[model samples]
Target chain A: MIEIIDLTKQYGKFTALDCLNLTIDKGTVFGFVGQNGAGKSTTFSILATLLSPSSGTAYINGFNIRSEPKAVRSQIGYMPDFFGVYDQLKTVEYLDFYGASYGISQSERNKLIPQLLELVNLTDKQDSYVDILSRGMKQRLCLARSLIHDPEVLILDEPASGLDPRARVEMREILKELKNMGKTILISSHILPELAEMCDTIGIIDQGRLVAQGSVSEIQQRLKGEKLIVVKLQHGLDEAVRFFEDQPMVSGLVKREDGHSLQFIYSGDAEDQVQLLKMALLQNLAIVSFSEIETNLEDVFMEITKGVELT
Target chain B: MRNLLLNPVLNKEFKLRFRSFKSFLGLGLYLLALSVLMVGFIFLESQGSPMGRFRPEQSRTMFILMSFIQMGLILFITPGLTAGVISGEREKQTLNILLTTNQSSASIIFGKLISSVSFLLLMIFASMPIYSIVFLYGGISPGQVLVVLGYYIFTILVFGSIGIFFSTLVRKTIIAMITTYGVTLFLTAGTAFLFAVSMSVSQMGNSSNNPFALFFVMLNPVMILFSFLEPDAFSELSNQLGLGSEFPLWAANMVTYVLIMVLLIFISVKKLRPNMKVKSRR
Candidate 1:
């Protein structure tokens, strides 16, 4: 678990993190969402014990980051956003070096290297030179290096930043596996959908301030104020649209390009929704499908930060 | 102490340094330059003395020349090797990862210093055959050779520590390298120039004895090595300069260098610590 309290970081006159506070529970994946220069990396660096907070404290697994940095460092695995691999070093050597840096013995590293490489799907390239690997491979290797000590918390800053779509999916799968293994993860990325799918909770930071924090649906519901419903018609599309347009519960409606489906924002309770469906059936409207259209994290983010400008 | 010596950064530095062709080429060029000097010294000696006869005095001069050249090489190459040790990591963006590990800043600093000094020692040891050529004529003793080796080690520590200190202070490797060389140059040539001025000032004041002049000479590593090689010349100069014979000159020089090296390493470790500025502010 990670806890940050009133963490503020100021660089001369400019504030990088402004009284930011967040908590990540054990075995939960907390996605940190923000645009560029949004204090996400600053927060990650502070938690990793690589940067000092100007006037705040952070704790990882009950160890304070500023006072007990070594303990905090031992408990967390940090993968930086833009890290470089040592040239002329083999993949296994790279992992072993970091393992030794964490005070892991040779025997331990030897046993752990293969397992970690396999976890990142880089076992075949264990003997290859690190410089010869592609960017995606290097990123995976860095991930494996971070996990060399089997840390309880993972602080990954843009783990899939520059990766291709396939590589990003692979990284996401590995992260999900890490979550299943009971590791607490605090990840920051610009990709909202991936975070929405991967994180138990998402915290949106803007201009060094945490503007929003909640589950995907909670944020969506809080910002949009209505549930979206889609009704697919086999033959009664005009009737369905007319009926919803005249209903008091229907706030907005838009017909799909397919001409057989209609999407509408329904400001009603569950009982009202069920009653509306029953009424449509009684009217003999040929309804092929009726389902709620879920709003994604991207939509929620845009809605929440509608008037806010990026710093 | 053993754990400090066996740190992971030291091991990785050794592996990466020796694995590259650059290390081999540097060693080869170093030995080739020494070989040229050795052969050239013998050739010039034969031309002056005729009959191609070897002499003990010639052997002594050759030993002194070779030691001087080796020390010069160490002074030149140590900065190139160590000035980039930390800044290069920063440039590669690996310093942050290293800092976030459980390894202490002292461990990383010492590991980098030891690794660079160990490679310099390897090159010095590899040129032992050339030193043995001096022993062939029976002028320098094995004890003398041992003392010279010890002096070489101390000099490497001093220069390598300076390199590391600058590496930690500067952000770019090239800037660190230049600053390291600049400081070293000031320590050597600048001290000599100040010593010369002190000598003339003492003479102008009708007192040819100035311990301060000798102190400035002690700041120069080459002068220290020279004093070790030709003790009679040092003694004669001390007699002229009216220096006290209380402490041995070589011991004083060694202590000065060792003290400076320690201070430089301490500052480097403190600079490399992530929270040092915050701690200082508090």
Candidate 2:
């Protein structure tokens, strides 16, 4: 459980995070999506209790990040964006060090570490030196380190970044297992579709502001008016474009470079779309196929951040 | 306090440091240097004497030289050991994750300082058997050796704290090391230079006593060690600087170093935070 309330962070005149607010309930996975210089990492840093906000505060599992940072730290495990492994230490030793830092007893750590290594699919590499491991293994080791204390919440910043496709899938599978274990996870990723599959909800932040927040479909539904329609024509592509431009719901039309298809923003509902397609057929525009493009999380993110529909 | 001493950072540091061949190599090289100093000193003494006949008083000179060399080694090695403690963590990007754990900032700083100093101590202790050569000469008492050991500890802590302070203040390890060496040089040599200049100025100005010279001389660790090792020469210098008979210069020097070490440790703990503003419960 995490609650961020009106958190503002200012570095002189530049506002890294501006009066932002967010909340993630227990057992839910929240994905933070933002471009570089956006406030996602800044927000995660604040919630991780590493940086103090200039104004306002956050709470993790009912512990105030500002007033009760130690409690907050105890409740949540944090994995930063970069891999921070000590090259000289073996994987198990590395995990043990973090476990000890969290005050986990030797017996408990001995038990927990094997379970953690299994969770991250790093059991065999337990005895291997961290430096010798591949990037993916090191990342997984970092993940295991975060989970060493069995914290109720996880704050993972770009955990899947820089991994190869297979490693990324492995990471995703581990996250899915974590989701099943009922851990409240806060993750951020540049890979939108992977995040869409892993997160229960995604929050889009733009230029230090949370522009959109909801499930992927919920965000797409909110931007329903901006749905794009692709029309394939056997002939009279120019004529169809002119006809579609005259229609009340059609705007932002662009001809396909292939010269056979065109797309336009369609604001009408399903029935209205059918009626418009019927009119195009009646005009003898030689329409071969007409379909609406399903907006994915990437589209929603772009639409929100580009000062388009969500703004 | 026990938890602080056995903190995970210290344990990890010990493992990381000792597991490497470099530590043992460094210790071996250190002892070799000390052995060479002894052999060279013995050769020069025997060369001057008839058919290697030795004077017992020369052992005292040898002890003093060996002690000064050990002190120099401590001063030279302490900054290199400690100046990278925190900054290296930062470079490796592990400091943030370490901070996010339940370990307090003070524990991290203290653990690092102790770990580095412990390795230096191990080297110093390992050299004790080598010091048996001096012991066999019968000029230096065991009490004097213990006092020298205690002085080495104080000097190590003082210089190590200075290194850690800079390590916390700066981000780059090389920069921290440079600054640490700079401060150490100033404390050791610059203070002595300032004392010389102050005494010269006092002599030319017809002033019998200069507080500046006294202050500078008292702050110099080398001068303090000399006060204990070569008291007659130190007294002449002390008298020239108008030092009173009320307090031993070495004790006053240790107190001054203790105060400085405390202040540096305090500042280091505060500055160790990645962000200066680490807010806790109101």
Candidate 3:
């Protein structure tokens, strides 16, 4: 659905985006994950045609952004991170305004506005002035504006940011519905776990470069070689960890937190892990709970960037 | 189809111009001022000598001058009002949303220009009664009033277009406003200043020396209105200047005004290119 080649954007001495190359397939939700100042917004702005890339080319569904911008614009819905809501305009009028910009007929826009409001779960607020809306409501209204023309692709930058948990959940549901509608979605967000849950594929960027790109399981498996497991116990966790350190498969045992919880770096087969658990049980160690630790996105992200700022 | 693109801009303009108490007060105050000027004229006329406020037979001139003052107010307010139209959108972060739409840049620029001028027109038209009362004085012609009002509208549109063009070019409203004010000042006032300086430079070229010396005076909108009222003054000045009238005069004035407007609008459209893409980049 989209292709970018050697996309480099520079603002004088500062290289905001560096020779970035990416290809996104149609009908997929792609999560763009990076720390703050990782050039995520820069990349999105280039795609949205809000900012010109200092170098490189971008294509939207085969339409070159620089050449056939009108066609590309007509097919895409873009929600900026920081956008304004016209205070006096009704939610429907706001949608109508954008639809008119797209050359949608008045009757056509009227028909679409109600459906879009419903899709964004803002049907009741359609008659309300946009200014009266909460931040989350306004964000949803922005999303509705983007979709007014029934765009084929959605590029949402930080759509869930500043949203309350419930609002975020609502936005997630709406995004899932969009994904199901077969629209290609590209979302840039700092919330990694949410992206991990929401995206079909993910790209990790650091210092204006893509450090990794894959599904959650693929990224997790790639980092499992240096897997970390932190075990919290009910009490006397130190004695259990000391005994766990002596086990054959347990290569490293460090007190993970305040000497009560221990992190084990184990290199062992499934049977070796069972044996270690048996050894811990054999000792008079109080095991509050024990289970295999799953690697969360935070650890993988930290490992990937090595704590370097992208900008 | 283009009308659809312009409607939002028009609607926005109308809403803001009429809804705000300030706009209402401004328009009402303008009406009050024009009426006061009329009342002053009649009160003095009743006392005889026709008040001698201006030329007696040139009551048409007074009417035209009244409209000219109204036009001046519009010209001033337009730059201050619309200098921030586009740049303010960018500041508020709403411009990006507007740019990404399928609407062409031409539509955006045209819509904004019309919207700004619409507000100016509302204030100008609100003083229609004061203008009509000028006919009560018996020296003013209705067709002349219409023509002068036409020129006033044209001038306001030209000035408003300049304001909007600067709005798009500058990143901040203050800068846009300052640039617009400077340009307006230079084009209208500076032209007269240039004429005066040139006329003063030569021993014979005093206001009497050169017919072409008054050429720059055409740039001043009020001078043109004045000329229409007192054409003999132009000839008398030309006689002193010792030169024949080679200039197309009003034809030249019309062409210049139209050309200025065209240039301002063209530059505005160019500045508002529909370049912002909506699709997310890879």
Candidate 4:
């Protein structure tokens, strides 16, 4: 569990985190969505007790990050965005070193390391040098190192940033496993779709402020008046396209590659959608299926931060 | 104390340092350099002597020469050993993770310092047989040898702390090493140079006791080492500085070095966590 209250961090005139407030419940997977330099790392660093906030404070599992940093440190595992591994150490040795650093006894470390390695799907490579492993494998090793103390919360900042698609999927699967194990996870990334499939709730941060926070569909619902409708047609694609094009609500009509389906962005509510559907039926445009498509978080993010500069 | 003894950083550093071929290569090169110098000095001494062989009384000079050479090696090697401990971690981006762990700043700093100093100690201990060569001639007393060895340990501690202080202060390892060497040079050579210049300058005037000159002499590690190795060698400097017989220069040197080392360690620990504000909750 994590609760941040009015946490602000400033560097002279530049604000890295500006009076931001957020909370994540126990065993909840909260994804922090933001572009690069959008204060995601700053917020996470504060929660991890690595950076001191300018004004307010945060709490992890009832321990204040500023006051009880050691308790907060013991309760959470932090995997930084740009961490470097001890290349000279073996995978097991690396994990062991961190375990020892966390004050775990040697016997406990010996028992916990193999299980952590297996959890991250790095059992076979435990004996290999850390530098010799692939990027994905090293990421998994770092994940295991973070889990060495078995902390209740995990603050993973961009865990899958540089991974290839397959490795990203691997990381996702491991996170799913962690989710099932009932660990509260706070992960951050600039890519929306990456966290869309895995996160239970996502918060969009921009320019040191949190703009949106909710489930994927909840956020999409909050930004109403713009809905995407897909119409599957038996025929008459040109006529249906023209009909929707004539309507004031419809814009950005996209024809599907499959000859049967075409989608269009409609800027109207449910009542208007129903009226539009009635008009399409009256036109007898040979409609097979007509339904509103759920907008993904990526589109929701774009719509929310519309005029904001990226990078 | 127990925690410091079994520090995980110490364990990891030892494992990494010894496993690499570089450690062995460094040790081998170090011994080879000392051996070549010792052999050359002995050969030249034998050629200059009337009997065409080294004499017993000459072994004391040889021991003194070897001790100075060993101190020079320590002065050269300690900076390279300690000046990268923290800055290298920063460069590799591992400092944050280490800081987030349960280890306190004191643990991390002391762990790094002890580990690096232990390596330097290992090299010094490994060269013990080289010193044993002087023992065969029976000129140097075992007590004198112990005193010199103790002084060498003190020298390593002072210089190693200097390296770590700079390493923690600077963000880049290369710059940290350069600053460490710069400070070390100022301590070893600059102090002696200033002492000589001040002594010469004072001779033109009252030529009495100058506390500045006395302070320079006490701060100079080379002078302290010589005082330990050959106490009479300090007589001229001691007489000119009006130093009392009650407090020995070597004792004053110990207090000064200990004070400096403690100050450096204190600053290093404080600087290690510049942003960690620990406020106790009511």
Candidate 5:
């Protein structure tokens, strides 16, 4: 659980966060969506008790981050966007060092090291020097180091950046497992579609301002009026396209396949639109699947943050 | 638990500072040079005065003086060791991870300070055999050696803390190191010059002792170190048998120096308190 109230940060005349207010429930994957220099990392850094807010109070699991920072720190784990491993230390030794930093006992640390190594799938590489590991492996090890104290919440600032596809998938799965284990996570990533599939709630930050924050569908619903439908047909898509062109609600259609599927960008919601499908059915278009694909977070991001282009 | 929490920093410094072949090579050559020079000094100066000739009485004085000289070099290196504690971590991008942990800023700063100085202390301690050789000349007492060693310890801690403070405040290792060296230089050499000038100026009129200038001597570790090293050389030049009022009784200077070291450490810690801000969560 986390609560940030009126969180504002500034550097002289430049503001990093603008009276930001946000709450994340336990076990909820809260995606902090923001472009570069969007104050997302600033907000994360403050929550982790690494940066003092200019004016704000952050609470983690009911512990005030400014006052009871140690208590708050004990309850939260932070994985920075970029991290370094102790160059000379082994993977397990590195984890144990952080475990010791969190006040975990040596005996307990010795026991936890193996489990953590296994969790990150670096068991065989426990004795390997951390600097020699690949970027993704290092990232995974950084995540495990944050978990050495078993903190209740994880604030991961762009954990997937620079990771290869397989590594990103593994990182995602690891985070999903952490979420399934009832740990609340605040994740920031450049990959919007991946976040769209994983996050229950999302907050978009642009130029130190929170322009939108809510569920996926709720955000999509808030998009300026228009709807898009993706149709996947088994066969005879040419016939289906000609039949759907007559529909007044369909403002635009892009043929995506030779004789299969295409998307219809409709200007109106036009409920009880089954009449169009019925008309297509009469044409023997052999339509297999047809559904509305509303605007995604990526579309909304482009819409809102494309700033001057949108203007 | 506190020690465990501190060990990583100490461990990193220990492994890196000790495991390197160059460090060991430096230590070996340093010891060899000191031993050869010490033996040569004792052998050649066993008979007449040390200036044009040598006296057994002044032989111990020379050793004590050399001990302080070695401590001066120790003082010089202490800042180099501690100056990188924070800034080097920042350069490597390791400071943020440590800062984000449950540990308080005080602990982080203290741990770093201790780790940085730990190796210097080890190097100084390794030179103890050379210091112990002074006892064989029968002029200096074991207590004097201990008081001198105590002075050196405080000297290193103060210099080391100054370095750590500058390291925390500066973002570059070279800048932090240069700043630390500059501060130590000012404290060690600058304070001595001020005291010498004040002592001379005060003695010109009424032969009155300047408690204020004497007070600065209390604050300067190197000056206390100089007091412990240098015997009453002026009196010795006049062929006095024993006792000169020039060196503020060694025990007193030693105690005063230790107290100053403690106070400076506290100042460093206090200065760090307001700046080490905690991170914010989103």
Candidate 6:
């Protein structure tokens, strides 16, 4: 439900967002992956109507960000990377205040507050002062505040940053639940694996430009050339090594630190792999285990951003 | 107008301000200072009089003294209350989220100015019993007391708008506070000094009416209060300046201040909008 068309933002001579174009469909969780100062926050701020793009424009739910900012704001919820809570406000009061800011009625906020607190697992702490909450809890409260208006889209800038591992998992689960509830989320995080697991589509941004955008598997397939395979033999390790060495598909082979295993880079299809296994069995090598090493999101990201410099 | 006044920013500000211990402490300190001044004035009046019988004219002077003190307190407290309204939000990193909401920049500015003015009004109202002390000896009427309170309200509007204007212009709260105080001091004291200098210059020259001198002093709230307490003096000055007008001096002063306050608030609202400068550049 979000579309950014040739969006460029320049602060004097330094460009913050450089001719970047992206789109996220309705009810999809789009993970924005980038390192520090990679224009993720700038893009989010532009979409949220908190910053004007130097050139081009964006739209959310069919409303232009620059021209119809109020409508855009009404359709989107934005949570900044760092924010402060009012000292004397309670959790419910904090949400109530934002609800009113979005022009949500009192009755609707009263009904929505408890549901939001429960969604963020902060229902028990709803009566506590916002300043007294832990950082992770405060982050969750911020998420709830963003949802107070029940916007169709959520623009979260590093929602899981600075959280403990467990809190990160909780946040991940909450985002997953939000996805199930059909909210289109554009979440930016440097953590690659989490985004891989949570996102339907992932876009990598570098130096204000989107370097890569696709599904995780699609990116992996695009970057994958030679697949790494490991073979573990109970006895007949020499026979397995010789078999792999003789195979034309096996380009390079190395013995594992364990005395009984052989690892090799194989450029082969599934049929070739099956034939190699059949040949191993025919050679009477006691194969314990054989598996292909999967390429992860981190590897894909590193391969894509290898020579990139900070802008 | 109703929607503009009853905004989320105002609602939250009122709640946070009144609920904090600082509000109570500020009120207590304010009353204590006023009480000390009232008692000191009573002591001086008793000592100056023959039989401990304070005259009604002395009570009138005391009323005027208390009004000026209240005005001074307003001048001092209002800037401190409003100088951080926008810059504080920026420091807290909440302005982005606030701007992303449905609340307009005008609403936020109005809400902030009104809330700060409302707190100052509360302090002024709480000090009403101090006015009763002056009322025990009858010289100042209730209407006069109300007029003084109305002037205090006008002063709050002017000073509070100045604070908000500076707050939006500057990104740092400390700098905003300092600039607000500097501007306020210039308006209250420096303007009167310039008026005095202009009057002396006019006296030395051809003795013609100096509209600059009259306008400068009229901009000063202290001079406005003097004109309110003594209309004949303002009229005589106006007649001497060959600017005899249908409107009273206080009315003219209020109009001028109201215009200035509106300008400050308009600038503040514009500045508080995110990327407004960037948008304007396009």
Q: Score the docking of each candidate (DockQ).
A: 0.34, 0.39, 0.28, 0.33, 0.24, 0.35
lDDT score of residue B119 within candidate 4: 74
Candidate 2 residue pairs that clash: none
True contacts kept of each: 0.60, 0.56, 0.46, 0.59, 0.45, 0.60
What are the runs in model 6 whose C-alpha is more than 4 Å off? A226-295, A307-311, B236-247, B275-282
Model 6: per-residue Cα lDDT at residue B268: 88
Better of 3 and 6 by DockQ: 6
TM-score of chain B of each: 0.94, 0.93, 0.84, 0.93, 0.78, 0.91
Better of 3 and 5 by lDDT: 3
lDDT of 2 by residue, B211-236 (tens): 89888888888888888777789898
**Cα lDDT of all candidates, in order?**
0.87, 0.87, 0.78, 0.87, 0.76, 0.87
In candidate 6, what are the lDDT values of residues A143-196, reduced to their tens digit?
Answer: 999999889999999999999999999999999999999999999998778799
Candidate 4 ranges with C-alpha deviation above 4 Å: A227-295, A307-311, B278-282
| Native-structure RMSD, model 6 | 7.1
- DockQ of candidate 3? 0.28
- For A34-148, candidate 5 gives per-residue lDDT tens digits of 7889899999988887778888788899998788777877898899987777767878878887897887988999899898888888898898889999999999999999899
Off by over 4 Å in 1: A226-296, A306-311, B276-282
Worst 10 residues of 1 chain B by lDDT: B273-282
- Which stretch of 10 consecutive residues in model 5 chain A shows the poorest summed lDDT? A302-311
Q: Candidate 6: interface RMSD in Å?
A: 2.7
Candidate 4 has a TM-score of 0.88
Give lDDT: candidate 3, residue B202.
Answer: 54
Question: Tens digits of per-residue lDDT for model 1 on A1-311?
Answer: 89999999888888889888888899999999988888999999989888888887888999998888889999999999999889999999999999999999989889999999999999999999999998889999999999999999999999999999899989999999999999999999976787989899998887789888888777766745567799999997888888889888785588999989998777788899999999989889899999987777675665445433222
Rank by DockQ (best first): 2, 6, 1, 4, 3, 5
- Tens-digit lDDT string for candidate 4 (A60-112): 99998877888999999899999888868999999999999999999998899
List runs of model 3 lying over 4 Å from the truth.
A227-295, A307-311, B1-7, B19-22, B48-58, B204-215, B238-246, B274-282
Better of 1 and 2 by DockQ: 2
